[model samples]
Target: MGARRRVREVRPTDGPLLEVEDLRTYFETRRGLVKAVDGVSFELIAGRTLAIVGESGSGKTVLSRSVMGLLPQRNVTREGRVRFAGLDLVGAPEHELRELWGDQIAMVFQDPVTSLNPVVRIGRQITESLRHHVGMSRSEARAAATALLRSVGIAEPEQRLRWYPHQFSGGMCQRIVIASAIACGPQLLLADEPTTGLDVTVAAQILDLLQRLQHERQMSMILVSHDLGLVAGRSDDIIVMYAGKVVEKAPTATLLSDTRMPYTEALLRSAPRLTDGSHRRLPTIPGAPPDPSDYPAGCRFASRCAYAQPRCAEEEPPLRPGAVPEHTYACWYPVGTPHGAEALELNRAGGAVG
Candidate 1:
């Protein structure tokens, strides 16, 4: 055990803790094939955070679930490589994935209410992983669970542990859920809408807690959210998804500054900013997201994009490296390019949303 720990310590920090390659997750629905996460790929360096942002139906949640191999087996078809600590997760056996879950990888689900067992006490929820994975005795697990709750900002940790999930507020329950997720000090944490259903102040606190925990544990995290404002400042990198594919990906600053992909630009423009006047109308992206059951042969976002050209509606654009390093976008007429500007001008003159 000491030798194994020594090897991990000697490993280079530059190595990717998680590498996803051409991941595709489809569901065989009664209507048709639902391509929830289609041909998406990304990598995360050790101890960094990657934020997946998109509209509700853009499949950010599904992508995160696919990464953890946490989908139902009945109609789900997941393809491609998910390498975590150099282990391929896509085709790994159930037992192998079970060992990885909660110990090496953990998830904080979208809703805390449904995630926590209503009948179970808070202490059991937090200590289950600790006792099972770390083999801690009952007393040791109890003490560790108390510390975990305290670290997550839950007051009266010892007293609260004995209470049922129904007894706590949403914020407190969410904090307890987080405590359970971090119990084993997982190397990677997938946080799907960690602050969902939380008030603004509590949401901010939750985000701060997550960031603080990530830093202290040096764990890689994949944060999924629909709000652009939430991710802009928090994540090291951002990936924008549309129609089950990554339309734009870049460092947080680069993507915000040198904005590319018309769809991504629309999302940014639509997000309400603090600087806007109270009465100012909120901008919205025109047209609905495309259906995933029967995907378009051309670029999926072309129908709603102001800069889309004939080429965009005829041929799909491949995700390629941009002029800037570590940036990739899938678009025929990328925003910030001359053709894109011209197309936007023409579309606006033609009474299209621009």
Candidate 2:
């Protein structure tokens, strides 16, 4: 927003910054134990962007919260390891987790309205992290907060500092949220649907700003979104989740080119194409996602998959390696395979698939 550019430098790690192994986050409810995140594992290398894509209620947000140790206590039970920077956060102390929250790891939540305090001044909120984590003096934190505001494309940083969240536009409020999140230069940034409640142009601007900031800060980012097309070119690696489990994972280019999971293919098919005419009818996925409290013994996507066989309804598919080195998918009859082809044909003949 201003002429000055202040990009905080973070030391890059040779290995993964965050390593999640068989992480399961379950909440005990009156209905039953809701398995929010079921045995998810992934490695996020420093300075790389990992996009977790899935439809709503797919546990993308829950997985991010679990990695950040942001889940609530009491009824929630978390199993498995969430290692960040070589330290396991699963059973870490509350004081230690609090320290890592705004310092080494920061999160940009979906709604900017909820991310910021309506009553607190913008400058104060941004400076709080710098003062608490960075041990900056009052004046130093104030100056740094101004610089942070500018870095996130907020103009008139000095004046805007006195303004409240409701005083700014939706996109501007999100920028302020980003400024606060990055004030301390966290090594890992978790942005969960950062573009929510914004127009298309503003959404693009927010995404581009995040990418630019990540590169400049040398920060490993987890970009959580429900749209595959949204994170297509923005992420280095992509993980497709369904019903609390990761169904497919691969490098961005490879996953799009050689997709093995039927669920992933269905998502791609349902997405609106850029070259399509304006009046074209949008394709929709049949059937709804499975309920978390009552998960199926079979494949999570079996009910909605057109290529699903009788075995799919009886057996759960394990996450296995694909033809490509980096690609992995959880599907018995994978896309482009003879079994999948025959299954799809059978479904079409019997009026099961559109």
**TM-score of every model?**
0.95, 0.95
User: Which residue ranges in model 1 land beyond 4 Å of their true spot?
Assistant: 1-14
lDDT of each: 0.88, 0.90
lDDT of 1 by residue, 156-241 (tens): 99999999999988888889999999988888999999997999999999999999999998988999999878989899999999
Cα lDDT over the full model 1: 0.88
For residue 59, what is the lDDT in candidate 2? 95
Segments of candidate 2 deviating more than 4 angstroms: 1-13
- Tens-digit per-residue lDDT, 1-354, candidate 2: 232222323344467888999999999999999998999999998899999999999999999999998888889999999888878899998888877888889999999987899889989999887777777778888899888989999888899999999999999989998989988788899999999779999999999999999999998899999889999999999999999999999999989998989999989988888899887887677889988999988898999898898999999999999887778999989998887898899989999987
Model 1: clashing residue pairs? Answer: none
| Candidate 2 accuracy as lDDT | 0.90
Number of the top lDDT candidate:
2
